[model samples]
Target: MRALRRWWHDTAGDLPATFWYLWAGILINRAGAFAMLFLSLYLTEARGASEALAGAVVGAYGAGGAVGVLLGGVLADRWGRRATLLTAHLVTAGLMVALALSRHLLLIAVLSALVGVVHSMPSPAFVASIVDMVPEQRRSRAFNLQFWAFNLGMAVASLLAGVLAEASYLALFLVDAGATLATALVIAWKVPETLRRPARTPRGVPRIGSTARSARRPGLLTALTDRIFLTFVGLTFVLAVLTMQTSTIMPLAMRADGLEPSAYGLVVALGGALIVLGQLFVPRLIDRRRKGFVLATSTGLMAVGFGALAVADELAVYLGAAVIWTVGSMLAAPPNAQINADLAPPELRARYQSVFYLTFPAASFVAPTLGGVSLQYLGSAHWLVVGGLGLLAAVGHLLAGPARERRVAALLRGTRNGRPATSASGPMPAGGPEVATDPVRT
Candidate 1:
């Protein structure tokens, strides 16, 4: 208990204002975003839409997310992180309000797509901001804390949505919109701009772009094309195939077993609770291990969790599967952000994260729809297929092998070299790019 208190105190010290701003946004957004989980139910029960039509609407949302993520990254790089975050929240807030007021299925579908785009807006910029504010050594822990905060928010939101949705569906939309607007206000007022001016080059030196900015240095595109990034994207795509099955198919399985909607919310809350608890300890426990090994182990456990779900019958057994899955997810979450941060040059951090996150939106675009179709066709037994795919993802991550592992390690080492080492850092070594510095202690 004493050690735990000490750790908490140390982690809290000197955190950047940007961290709090981002955290507020996540807490608000997640706490009210439970509407997405129950959207199918809302459409079916309230709008009298068929399951097939509802599922199509959900697919449209996922597709919009893919486009939003790509656009957010470009805008973050061109405009700034603060601008992207505020705009996304405002857009999403308005869409949520529109969704609450509308009854038309087509309009709801369009609004859902718009919301999806805004949903992805804060991602790349926020992630880049975290990397900028925190030191390399503390990044893993910082991301873990951020993940925990979000999950806690999700748990609360799920419970609130479950209770309120039982009374009124429109209430959920109103609450979600309000939270988003609150988050936007926080961002605009509190978060500092982390963007640094690029280093200047000598007059005689050939310039790469319009300005002699070091942050705009070439070779970023080359880094993006590296085999390491490709392998990571491939691995994430497979992971998405497995994870989306949980959101798309698991609820149907529970309903088939006669679980109440409230019980389903409880199940999700249990997972979020586990993530909150696990994030506080797992990073420390695995601190001495190779990140790849940690990733492999966590993904392997997820496969086991899904397998448990495949066979589970009793409510207790199902909840146990949730526990297992949550643990794996908690372990996996911090590394996801850290790996991207490690891979990026300081100048292109936002771009790198944007590109890295693209795999999720891209994979999501297909996985959920496919999983829904499979669930409709295969019934409850489809979970076994999902479990099998998770196992395959674990194997793929493992097979990325020593070469990929070394590349990531090298990048990590380069990041630790203080000044940026990538050619993308600047045109000249003397006046190379500087990473944004802030007081994010963790």
Candidate 2:
């Protein structure tokens, strides 16, 4: 108890208003997502939709998310973070209300897409806000705190939603809509702007754009074309594929094994509980380590966990697999953001984050459909195939050895040479710090 007290005291600090506001909003919004707990069941049992149709509706959400992420990045870069976030919440709130009122399949699909779009809009801005508020050293801790808070909220929401669904599905939507409105209100009133714009040149001097055009230096597209950044994005794509298998197929597998809804709920609860506990220690374990090494190890652990799931039939075995995956998830969460933070210039941080985040929506788009198809065709053996793909992605990271180091070195060298240390074009110089060193604790 004394140690816990001391830890709390030491970690206490002022976080950005945006962080608290967003965290609160997440908690509220997630609490309302109780409907998601039974969305598949609702569509299949209540609404009488085909399995393929349900998958399409769910997958369409991902499609909308992809579009939202790209647009959000550009808007956050151009308009500012606060505005983008506020707009997203407002739009999402309306969509939730619409979804609650409608029953037509096509209308539901459209509303789901809108919900997905607005739901994703705040992510880039929110993540960029964290990067802006915290120092590099503490960034991982800060992100971990955010993840912990998010999962905690999710766990609560999932439980409550389940309870509410047993009462009324429409009630779940109404509750969720209310939460979204509350979130939007908090953002509008509490969150501050965090977007960092580029410095303007003197009136007589040619604009940086004109100069870059003359010099033939590459632009944002060219900078993103970097081998390391692209590699990380590719690996994240694979991780997304593996992780989605749990949400998409695991429940089906559990049902096949004779687990009831309550039992399946317990399994999800356990995973969330593990994440909350694991986040507490994972930051300390990876303290001051290279981001790449942390990421590689996490991905490898995830592969092992997924592989275990392929063979496990007993509930205890499934729980054990969840524990392994939870650890990997905790490790992977912070460093993923850290790497993107390292790669992006201060001015373009939000844009880079938005683009990097594209992988989530992209993978979401592919994973559900593929997982469904695989399960329909391959049955239980599909787990092996999915786990194998995760292992392959982990191996890819291993083969991409020292790429992070090389990228950092190049970034530092470019900075030292004063070669327009911008992210719109050009490579990061070498020999700089590999991981961000500041604590994001607040």
Candidate 3:
């Protein structure tokens, strides 16, 4: 008990009031996140749309998200983080009501797309806000707390959604709208804007925000050219793909193997429960470990989890695999966020976050299509292939993790020496193109 108390205190110090509010707001929004989970069913069964049209409409939501994330990143940098979130949430609230009231297929589709646009636009800013709220050392713990709350809300929502979905989806939409609006109000009232805007700096004196502005930012294109960051994005996307397999393919495999739908639900709920309980414990325990080690371990667990399902027949076995992957997911997430935040300079913070946030939509867009195709073609053998892919991702992260550390350290060294940071190559000479400093992030 003494040891546990000490660890908890160490992992969680006093955070800002705004951070707590942010946490609460995120929890509320995620709890009512019922629409996307049930949208397909609503379109097809509830509204009597053809499968193809329903798919197109669903696709519209995702398309909007893809666009929204990019737009959100720009908006965060251009406007402020709190402002961007306020706008996004307000619009999302309005759209949820509009979607609930929407009866005609055309109107529903348009509103859905619009909803997607605003709905996803807040992601980069939201993550950025968390980073801004916490100090360097507590970032992983902060992110883990946020991540845990998100999944907790999701788990609760998933359970309630089925029960509520049986009655009226309108109730679901209204609740969702209410929660989002309340969250918007919380941000509008409580959370301060965190984005550093460009302002005129004196010739010699350096203001903090001004220094952020003067970092010779190469814009989104320049951010894209960042070798270490780009590599991180690629690896994150791969991890997202593995995660998608759990959602898309795992269910299909379970049903194909004669397990009931409830079996999958039970497995998912159990996984969520594990995350809610273990998220805080795992990251704190492993906080001292290298990011690469965490990433590698996560990928290895994913490989093993999926590999286990490929052979297991019992529900017990399936649930065991679920637990393994859930722990793996929790372990990898905070480090990933920490790394992304570390990679960006204050000037390019939002844009870098947006680019990093691109992994989700990118993975979302690709994963379903690819997994569906693979499952359809490979029949029973696809799980093994996925496990093999996870193994490859593990190897990739192990290699990339160390390489990322080297680059960040070198960049920090360069910055301390009054030189701009170099790319992921050898030691940069003085006055070389400078990079923003990032030490031990990711």
Q: Candidate 3's C-alpha lDDT?
A: 0.74
Instruction: Put down candidate 1 lDDT per residue, 151-202, tens digits, no spaces.
Output: 9988998788778778899998899888888888888888877766567767
lDDT tens digits by residue: candidate 2, 1-442? 9988866543434555566676776666665655544555566656787656666777777788888987887788789889998899888878888888888988888887777788778888888888877766566667777778777766777667656655777888888878878877888888788776657866554333232221243334533554456667788888877776666567667766776555555666777787766676776678677666676788878878877876777788888887787777788887777667766655556666777888877776677666667766787777788778877776676665365545544554554565544332232223433321211100
CA lDDT, every prediction? 0.71, 0.68, 0.74
Candidate 3 segments exceeding 4 Å error: 1-4, 40-59, 101-110, 198-218, 246-264, 307-317, 376-380, 412-442
Task: Tell me each candidate's TM-score.
Answer: 0.87, 0.87, 0.84
Candidate 1: lDDT over CA atoms?
0.71
Question: How well does candidate 3 match the true structure in TM-score terms?
Answer: 0.84
- What is the TM-score (0 to 1) of candidate 1? 0.87
On the 0 to 100 scale, the lDDT of residue 424 in model 2 is 23
Clashes of each: 0, 24, 4
CA deviation > 4 Å runs, candidate 1: 9-11, 202-224, 415-442
| C-alpha lDDT (0 to 100) for residue 294 of candidate 1 | 71
Quote the positional error of residue 388 for candidate 2 in Å. 0.6
**Alpha carbon RMSD to native, model 1:** 6.0
Worst 10 residues of 3 by lDDT: 433-442
- Candidate 2 lDDT score relative to the true structure: 0.68
